[model samples]
Target chain A: MAEFWMSEIIKECARQRISLAEYIIRGECENSGSTREQVIEKMGKMLDVMSSAANGGLEAPIRSNSGLTGGAAYQYHQYIGQGSSLLGTVMSSAVEMALSCSEVNAAMGRIVACPTAGSCGIVPAAVLSVGVSHQKSREDMVMALFVATGVGMVIGEHATLAGADGGCQAECGAAASMAAAAVVNLMGGSDEQALHGAAIALKNMLGLVCDPVCGLVEIPCIKRNAIGASTALVSADMALAGVQSYIPFDEVVTAMYAIGKQLPAELRETGRGGLAVTKTGLAMYETLFGTPMSL
Target chain B: MNATYMTGSYSVFDITGPIMVGPSSSHTAGAARLGKIARILAHNSVKKVTFQLFGSFAQTYKGHGTDKALLAGILGLNPWDLGLRDAFSLAEKQNVEYIFEPVTKPTQQGWENYHPNTVRFLITSENGEVFDIVGCSLGGGKVRIISLNGILVNFTGESPILVTRHYDGPGIIAAITSILYQDKVNIGNMRVDRKRHSTTADMYLELDSDVTERVVEEIQKIPGMLNVILLQRINEDQSLNNIE
Candidate 1:
């Protein structure tokens, strides 16, 4: 039928110029009527859930019958280990699959542009980090999720969340959009600035792809999620600080969708392109699946 | 709530998979969303589903084993498809025909904020009935039920909620509520989805209990709300209730 968001909601910028994070922050300050403490408290609660899940509560879902998505996140949190410790939060919240770079985390997470499992960590990481920094209450995290859910609803309405459907661009890009929009909301962003931040965050990840090595959710999948977590936070900060995308959020999404359509199957979660296609990629595939993936 | 999140039209009652469990939610959940939509579109038995998957979803269908998930869902597997993961082998055993397309263009676009997750299915029956639904599986096992053919419906497994589209009119809400009220169904929270000025709109109501067949029918008869769907509470399908 008709796509949800045929029109752009925020502007898009071609280059990484200005403190887009700060821009978004200012937008939130200007619009959202919520107090700064309200935002901080919500961010804190998100950390509590993540911290608890990361430690040992994941099996509760399996024993209780929660679906795979929630199960995976909780289990992964447990799988990584947890604590009130800073590093533990960073590690568990991050999939850490594999990466070409090792940037020092300033308690910030980047959205790996797109790619679900890996992309999940960004928002959680940022929100939690902010929580710890601000000494906020845990009661607000759930509220933050409600807020995040609304923004996510808008993006989902307007864009794609399928790696195969669009590319890693959609996965990590969408996650970044969610993370940015969510963080901005928590930090007291107005709906206008929040949507604006999301547009910018998504625009940054215009043509990412889903290249899970060996078709497993490890490797780049894990690391990508962490990067996405951090990047989304950065974008959120920029939006709050008054960074503008030049082109609206809707236009960026359209461009991303267009780019996704042009992506080859090899780059779109086939385990045949990007990092999955290198000499190491072939070796990894041979090691795991017992042979090279045929196109 | 922003867009039609669960529209994969084809099988709410297709009998292809053996109790529909999964190796793939695209095959299983996406298929289930379609089946649910089918049930919503036509309260009658579905005849067929022109299931379609583009890009990598098409390429790795066999490996991911989505074919069986689709078959089983058409056959009516609740969310708890233990066999969902092995659906391909099972589908092969059952022999259901499915089509594949590699649309360099994705079914859903503009959501770089999430993942590029979209799967569309065109389900039809031999008796001249057809519908479509699309889904987005946002990583870590989360999925968004996008569009149901054209009847925009949005749902995530959050609550035991039911959403219906009705010809915007007075008394319809009260009439629909009476059916649930008679059934002793507890209304946890309800939101009438209206953008600005409302016409034919959607009503999203979360319930504290499972709806009975009668409740389903009563709400359906409420003059303006066209089709009604009872969305189960989050984790209801694959959760503790099915532990046995």
Candidate 2:
């Protein structure tokens, strides 16, 4: 509550002999002047919004106005239901849900950005998928989301969340880290283990650039949400199984910020470099806008 | 980064901006909110509106639907409004004259005080009332109304904002606060911006809760008070939930 650094968060959790979610709740209560019950109730509404987004995408996949993304979430669901996925129920379903949220976003439907709209799918996909698979109670899931919020708050304070500033690493990358920590907490891992999951997830995703084709939140953005979800699941499993990150969560975040600072402006959501300037990407851009992109 | 963001005063609502219809929060949602603020300033008397976009918005407003988003907002639609897609045609049908002009800036940071996602609205009412406002979309579907009629004023669409234009004099602040106190409405925060050596000033207040129409009427009745308008709350009350 006194500080927002990951180190301070972990220390507060340990010093208070409380779970990470409880520490987050107390801090939120102090910071926002809201009661615990109010915070929990608000979180519940967010969960409902996430659920509705996924369900809407699955029921009838409306193509985004860009026509670049649609039906993939439902298709993924169908593919997962066929039992061909090696990721088992939790991870594969997470991917489907992740796609669902991104597709909904691309279609201009309602969505909650766990950090940013570009990466909205990552946290909801992981939390809802795992919660559904385990039939976890709403209270438990809300607690897990609080843990995720704590991780996100630390990253937002230390690094960045906007793709324009940091790149895809700050968007999808930060969301993946939050999802990983939430997954670990939901699975009954220690608060330290949850932070480790976050570190591992973020360490692996460092330097990822933001390069959506045609300056739209489609193409790489939607699929990347799915990948981000799976990565979070794997990282959370590793931490829950006693794996550790060589770099702590705070250090990993610092590295991400440093790398993001060095990234070319073209690679940081400018849609001028990386995959954005590819021949096909340019072709699609012209077809959509009726003019050639100067890049 | 500003001092407020640094202090970690951001609420949970800010994590993803507000839950709304979105493709790009910075381009669409933020633009709409800016338009909404301009509409409020125009007192819904806007007959003609011209939008000048700069920086990232100028280059990609079409693809991101920033044009439609802003127009929809001036028509009093929020980001979640499904009717945003039809905003252009709706404006024409409503007989609201509008034009969108893209201005090229050498950098996202404009030559002077322009932010990356900046917009200027020149709104003219049917009664010949003109209101010109400049705003910036600070990404994540957040917007800050930076200026009103060339006067430097800062307001983010976070709470119930009361924007008042009044003549500068003693007891101006106390008069407003007294009426608010009588109504049991708390002042979350407030800021006063005045012209140098001038009597005209702007008072921006973020109230703890929504104010009754009568409260605005009372404030308007005060001496030296020129105008009073409530920049309606955009995001719904997520602070308290009825679910037990």
Choose the strongest candidate by lDDT: 2
Task: State each model's TM-score restricted to chain B.
Answer: 0.60, 0.79
Backbone clash total for model 1 is 129
RMSD of model 2 against the true structure: 4.4
lDDT values of the candidates? 0.52, 0.83
Per-model TM-score versus the true fold: 0.47, 0.87
* For model 2 chain B, the run of ten residues with the poorest summed lDDT: B1-10
lDDT string, candidate 1, A147-261, tens digits: 4444454444455666767778776677667667767766777656766777778888888888866554444654565667667677777888888768877778778888988
Clashes of each: 129, 0
For every model in order, the fraction of real contacts preserved is: 0.01, 0.43
Per-residue CA lDDT of model 2 for B78-97, tens digit only, reads 77676778898999898999
Once fitted onto the true fold, the runs of candidate 1 whose alpha carbons sit more than 4 angstroms away are: A1-118, B1-244
